[model samples]
Target: MKRTAAALAALSAIVLTSGLVPQAKAEEKKPYKIYLSNNFVGNDWRQQMLRIADTVVKKAPLAGRVDLKVENVETTTQAQINSLNNIIRTKPDAILIDVGSPTALNPTIEKACAAGILVITFDQVATADCAYKVESDWSMLPAVQAEWIAEKIGGKGKVFVDRGLAGAPISEQLQSGFEKVLKNYPGIEIVGYFNGNYALGPEQEGVASLLAAHPQVDAILTQGYGSGAIKALQDAGRPLVPVAGGGYNTASLVCAQTEGAQCILETNPAYLSAEALKLAVDILDGKEAKEKHVFVYGPFLSTDPQPSKLYPDVKMQKIEVGTNAFPDLAPGLSLPITPDWVEITPQEAAGS
Candidate 1:
């Protein structure tokens, strides 16, 4: 009897230990599957954005936690929708979209949300209520820049405005913001408007044509690279005027190097993709976001630095060579290249 009791106790101990091992295995969290659906890859910004997303998944904290897949589609809303439908069928844990159209992707995004897939639209975001949005505070960029331009030119001048890419939601928003700020200063006149199309060639051509027509232009508001506007001014033999443009490496460098240039550059950073990925991982890990829409703000880089009355909260950094402006890097490299949490070097961000 004593021997049998001892054997039964030993068997119980083994059973208990075996049961605990599977319980611990069951508690181990599996890596979540995440997909990035990029609508356009034609421009340098889009390329860099995609690169940043790819880099994030391979780095610490996110490396072992996410299985990221990127799907670049034709620059059409329908193409993205079709691709998203296919991705939905695969049932990924999350989907991040740099949407082509804001309203057109609502239904598809809703479908994904219904299927329990977290949908996050960054950069050019969608209007789907169910999906979360991660974007630069678009309203702040134009408002502050326009204010700077207004102040720089003594609250009045003939300003040229770049309408940005045609039919893009961000373009419309930026245009509206510019107009809204400039309206307060009755002396400021928007002498000319052109579609920069968010490219160097188009921006240069458009600005050059505008400069020819409006010889007395005082300032320029560019939605993309400011370098194009500076080049246009130089080509036309027009003196460099105070210009507000996007935060591109070339834009800051050109603005800093040009003898008479007075410029302010603001960024919608490409690290937004990485931020979206991080948000997705957080959600998947059961950390509920306090708000559905998350706005990531980048720095305001300027040649003549001053506090913004409109957006005082926004950080304004002096555009210094080798700091914000990299002379050695590619022209189209976006500014504020590295996010605070990640250490993405200039070469990596430039895709060198």
Candidate 2:
């Protein structure tokens, strides 16, 4: 028995010294490289979108599997084209784009596609035939709010129209939707039309200047910049009128506080970055999808339906405002729409 034990120990020693002992085989994971080509970072929504992408890429299952790089440039078509040209040369596995012009980037996008790189465009999308698009339905998003505004004013009142960036496809789509509804009500005079630029400060200033010139405004129709309009009205001591806007954190709270104020919050959530990233990852993983165009619809926030409230009888496309305006969330915080796979909380989004 002793000899057997000694021989076994000697064999073990020999195996260790000879490097015959098996070592753990480290996982050979090839990180999928992704590049984000953003046209602008001038607004809160755009910044939030980028942050969402960062968080999504760092989460489990994607943490070690993805290598993401983001590149931002001025909001010009030529700048974006130059950026795309430079990015294509790096030969990443996929490219996610937020463009300045719809058709300006088509040739470069086609070049990338031909080079075997997957190209996906989200908000501020391009008209590149070779690129996949992920975006919300712009027409439906504003039509519901426009209808609500018309309904609140009994189809006949002076209204102010706050537009987003001029020449932007989303801006044009939203305006078309709102105008289509407003056309049904000839009595609803459009008092003033100003470009809100989708930013709070610019919107506030523009609304304020318009208010100074036309103090008889009854309601405001806006694509974004709700909070700025709210403040402008408050500063002017004008009676709060029904306002409609794209999603704004501060606007949601302000609307909740105003006595006679009625507003609609239907925004394209910022987590769309995650959606774009998800598409890139899926494609890299060889997941097949039938359609290249992805459409996300906006959710209409119904108001608190209380008979005592000034705007209690309002409804948006049959979606009634629920019991709480901002349930389980603080005021002035943007809502984040995330799928289970992305795993992001609104608080995390807010903080970021």
Candidate 3:
């Protein structure tokens, strides 16, 4: 009996000493319940963002760690608020929002925070102090591209600026960035402004209308796909010029293929959802963020090698076929598809 007891005790001590107990405990930890609340799904960017989030939760690091539920509401502040109210009742471990209005969701977000639910807003983030924000640095997107345009056009040219979507905070922010950079270059003249609304049809129409009015446009600073501007210039029989726009796959491909086209495409990556998911898991696992606002700055894609003085630290990669820009993919697909942590193929990103 003494020998048997001694052997059992020895075996138990070996298991504990070998760290097997802790490892088993860690493996047994339950996955966190996370909810993604999105307001709009009208554009390719928003759709891609949702797809990326779905892909992320099924991959490693997040695959077994998160039980993610996506709740997409109508493109209205009130609709999102209503959806959030229902989400709050479920009391998931965390709630991630892509806000329709920055401040309109504050009251609802506060209610979520009050109930001890972690709230994280990304992309079009909210203004709730209690909710953490993970978003692209909007100021950099326009500033770097604007600086490149000023240099490409030799600091003097008639430039058309896209005002983006009406009444959107990001639109104003981008417009502000563009103006702030161009103000330094006295020779550069912003002759026309249009509402691109971040859609191809509106962007093309807006640019075409501007082209008809301004006979001497030297460059275009578009807030959406640069392809629309290219098509507008082509249809108007005007010479292809330098353009600064968003990093859409078609835009980069068009810039590369079109002769005499000088372009800079900035990315607001869809992987931000993945980032938010990771952050929620980290916080749930007892890791605290140093700051409430987590700023993710994407790469500056250029058709030609045009370095920036304003943003020296930013990654500026030359757009290439089958690399940064895929020719076989959908036009509306966002570029730089995969985040660094995971390997999401272009097919997966494009939902092919």
Top model number, TM-score:
1
Candidate 1 at residue 266, lDDT? Answer: 89
How would you encode candidate 2's per-residue C-alpha lDDT over 225-284 as one tens digit per residue?
476887899999998887887665566666666666677777687877888888888888
Q: Locate the minimum summed-lDDT window of 10 residues in model 2.
A: 304-313
Each model's total of backbone clashes: 0, 3, 0
Q: Which digits, one per residue and each the tens of the lDDT, describe model 3 over residues 178-288? A: 999999999999999999989889999999999999889989999999889999999999999999889999889988888888889999998899889989999999997
Ranking by lDDT: 1, 3, 2
Residue pairs whose backbone atoms clash in candidate 3: none
TM-score of each: 0.93, 0.84, 0.92
Best by lDDT: 1
Better of 1 and 3 by TM-score: 1
- Each model's lDDT comes to 0.91, 0.77, 0.90
Scored by lDDT, model 3 comes in at: 0.90
In the range 6-99, model 1's lDDT, one tens digit per residue, is 8989987788788843566667678899999998887789999999988888897788788889999998889999999999999999999999
Q: Order the numbered candidates by TM-score, best leading.
A: 1, 3, 2
